[model samples]
Target: MLKQTLQQKLLQKLSPQQIQFIKLLQVPTVSLDTRIKEELEENPALEDGSLANMNEPIEDYPDKDPDEQFNSEESSFDEEFSVDEYIQEDDYKDYGGNYNGDDDEERKEIPIAIQDSFFEKLQNQLDLLALSDKNYLIGQQIIGSLDDDGYLRRPIPSLVDDLSFSQNTFVEESEVEDMLKVIQEFDPPGIGARDLQECLLIQLKKKDQENPTIVLATRVVEDYLEEFTKKHYDKIEKQLGVNSEELKDIINEILKLNPKPGDSGAVAGKQLHVIPDFHISNNDGVLHLTLNGRNAPELRVSKSYQEMFEHYEKVEKSDKKMKEAVQFVKQKLDSAKWFIDAIKQRQQTLLKTMNAIMEYQYEYFLTGDDRVLKPMILKDIADRIDMDISTVSRVANSKYVQTEFGTFLLKSFFSEAIQTDSGEEVSNKEVKKILEECIANEDKRKPLADEKLTEILKDKGYSIARRTVAKYREAMNIPVARLRKEL
Candidate 1:
């Protein structure tokens, strides 16, 4: 049913300026330069003026009282700074030219180049291998089929069929398997393995013989991977006829092996430079916080636009053209002013929220320790800052702060609370820390199970359930007790 009714519900909505400010507040220094360039491209009224030209004084201007320079009304939200009346059409017509001295400097361009993938590297190695054209092509096809983690996720039979159909040539599964074995023996050792066991075994087989740890690690990975991963040391000991000391030594050797060999070098070719959003330093006993100053560039309405607006206002004779010009100037100036004001507001909000967080987790920031991190969530910060939880969350996400310890993502400090046996609330981060420490210091031969871990945490005052322990363990990427077992 169509109905028209007058509804009166008090609701809050963010203005366009406020929204723009919030987005700008979250971006770090590294991204700010790109963002400013984007803004300059989008808004004709804004430009990156020369520093020398900016300092020059404006002549023939009506003077105002010095005390009225920063009046309360000037800062009030109700005061509408209309851009429509401030900017002229003629002013913006010539504004698009290369005004910032260097044409190349004005055009912001990010240098991006295509780089070689792991498959490409493997194919290059294949080219060096002495093989028939058919074998070389099959090897290249096999290399292309491998995943980023250096695993051949596709089955041998499936790949054979794919090659037979795609290449219009009959290829046997045996041929694919032989080529895979050769690829597996490539520099990374585990590149073409189909499964975890195969991957580990391939890496183990390539280790230097002089290292006893590598030999033992190879033996464990080959024979007792299933038992070792599940922390089933008792089963492994019974199967291999090894004692606790032998098992512990073997497990320690296995621990030294890289599970993901390809990952180490991946970042070197593909890490985006990060600029810290906030800076934290200790000033005496108090922790000082500063939002990255570069994120908020000094933006203002162009001086030329301001001058044109002033000129239009001063002319005694009023005409249609003059009125239109005044309207155009006013509109551009208002937009420019709104953008600059938004930038300032964004900085204030970010500082306010971050300051509250710094105060909330004072101990953690002061002492570079995760254990000191208090039980904090988005709601806690929201309540303190008198903002919505979503607002606080947006501020937390993708925002990083540089501390004396190291630069950390702001979201890392927030953790959900878990109730202890004694009814005291503790952060999940503390529990994870305890879990990590327990594993780090545990007897590898008889690594603790989830139930045992639960009991251990219970003994330490945390009354968490077995399932909760498993969840936390999984989050930390620690496998089951059987998988965690050595020997």
Candidate 2:
């Protein structure tokens, strides 16, 4: 048995409007339109249109208090209300949405590949065989099992089981293997290899086998693959009795093989362009920041919806159906206002957060130099913008910025601090940039090791450890010295 007790406590629960604002804030410029379209379809009160009033001046919509929170409970129809009391008089500014940017290509341009899907082409190629219905179904099942890389990774037993249960046909593994061998001969040279080695061999088998280089290359791939991948040229030479020049040609031929056969020969497919969430420009040493809002559709309360709400409110409070209609209209209106306000808050927060980041990385953005990036973290921007670190992270994580040098993810600019010998604070990005340069300029025959890299950084006044150097190298996708070596 439990005893009743009185207690005082505090709890924090996200309101629906607050949750919507958080979600909208985190959405990048690329997905804003889809999200807005979803809301438009879900709520008839919301519609895409010009939020900018041509008749009213901009000053008439006074800047809303960013700190103010939206509360849906406050809009309950059961409570006493007036026509002017519920109307929010939407405060969203159309920044390059429907009100502007009539020519910005709608924030993205994904070139649609006018061709068959990967599996479809493979299926078409499979159809040419004209196998029996059972064999064709088995082949179709096999084709469906292949991954995007064109590799059939599933075990033979698994395929047999799938076909037995799904196709109502029981077949042995040999039949499936025969069909696979037939489909592997399709176009693209390496359509049905099971692994990297198999993929390479399939491609090379399609090539001229009579060439001396081809013969030697097949030997290397088939026998000395381990040593060859490890760049153990000494062991390969000792075993194969080949000189450095001949070995180089052999290694080059094997290197040209496509490891992932599936990526190649897409008949037609979509290539999505990187739609930057923000744009930073250097105008004669001064920096300017602008949010890419071409995909942000304009949204507001429907005028007819508002009129319907008013007409229902004025008629009567006694009729049950009329009151229900009033309640429904009020709910829709509240939802519309909440979404509009959330969008406005999203814009404000994006601008606020990005402006803080731009100002924080002002020096680097000015000249597109990684060395000039100041040591910054989520907390720094959060403090600068008077927001939480989580909010700042949401802004930085999925966002991209277009710069003079190139498009960069916002997360790239943030790095931990490293104090120099001179007792001055510097960004780890600076050290990484220097580390990248050293590797880029080093001799590939004997690339610099992490210890040597650490010493070089220490010589330059960065007290980074060998482990830290390795971490940076790995972060930049650079391999170890042994892997970087070449003949």
Candidate 3:
């Protein structure tokens, strides 16, 4: 079975440069600076154009064209062409640009704030508590156990065991629970609750308990949580013996309580900052689209590095060491050139794709009208721009475009076509717009159901099913009729 045979088959593969370009193409305007900074730090031959030599005049030097110098078969580094003695730093190898799609999800990274994290803030609060060393440590453990939504998810017995094994500070369940209660009263009314009911009650108890509304709200949250959540107003009224108007005030009071106190700005969670990848403007009835300048950073080959390479190339009549040095320099120069080229291509591709989308959805962009949006998919833009669907998708993911209406995700513009009674195809965005209008204007006492909404769409000439209406409603984050009921 050791026989060998020649084989022939057609195959396709992306070159290193192509792979680099593809990755750079997908990075949104938000992280482009970080990616470039990484490239600058890694390759000595690459540098920020802002810091590059600008006073020097351009001259036709022999090493002026790095692409040609890089590709020419003048010299190459092989095993024999080693220069271990001259170079002191770590040996440079082939470069593989940062990402394999950056990651499968392409989620935007939130900028890390210098301020202490949520847990740290709680720890600071714990520092103020007057307790013994052991009690303080127990309090620290409880504060650490709180989740981002601000609930103590871990059980008391579990914390007791954790302290016993990890900290060697064995304590009973009751002791741990006492410390938890003490910390829960620190700040943000519901800091230490174990469940939704406890959280709401903690906030309610912090309010004016003497108020009839607060008293009724507590009763509702404690006894009628299920009915309240399901909008069974009738059941709640009959059980509590309260009129509809009285119950309405109590519901309003309960609604004011913070369901997730941990997410409150005073405690934890950094504020979200959205950096748009593109900006579109409608001026004099004409739309102009432009990519974010940050996306196209001005990068150039390091002049000093190029000069060093030229110096090594000039001392001709040299040995293997000199040639090896030249090869190393050439490799870096090549990477620097490729990275700059990829950046430019990424910029071009982004503009191309966005332009195609703008033209495709011109009416909507012109007036900020969802009803005018056309049925568009990734493939439509891909075909127009002569690119792959995945490429279009990469551009769309987690990316925002600033427009007259507001900053919106690019994926929001794309929707499947639905047929009208006249056989005219329309974007599902139009149907959603109508559904939103219907629900927004409907009487909260008798909210329209999905079936009724479907009939309304049908009457408006959109042929849609009840399930389809429900799906659209869910997609829009609109609650059902029963949940939407006020009293």
The order of the candidates by TM-score, greatest first, is 2, 3, 1
Residue 204 CA displacement from its true place in model 3, Å:
2.0
Q: lDDT for every model? A: 0.72, 0.79, 0.80
Estimate the TM-score of every prediction. Answer: 0.72, 0.86, 0.84
Order of models, best lDDT first: 3, 2, 1
Candidate 2 residue pairs that clash: 113-269, 115-268
* Best by the TM-score measure: 2
Which stretches of candidate 2 lie above 4 Å from their native place?
51-111, 130-134, 161-172, 265-268, 293-298
List of clashing residue pairs for candidate 3: none
Task: Give the worst 10-residue stretch by lDDT in candidate 2.
Answer: 56-65
Candidate 2 has a TM-score of: 0.86
Higher-ranked by TM-score: 1 or 3: 3
Candidate 3 structure quality by residue, lDDT tens digits, 1-487: 6998999997443345555666676666666776777788889898887655566543221211111113334323332212242122333332333322233245666555677766777888889878999999899889878888889989888999899988999888888878887887877789889999999988888888789889999999999999999999999999999999999999999899888887764444445556788999988999999888778676878888999988887888369888888888887898787778778777777788789999999989999999999999998998898777877887787578999889998989999999999999999999999999999999999999999998999899998999999999999999999999996
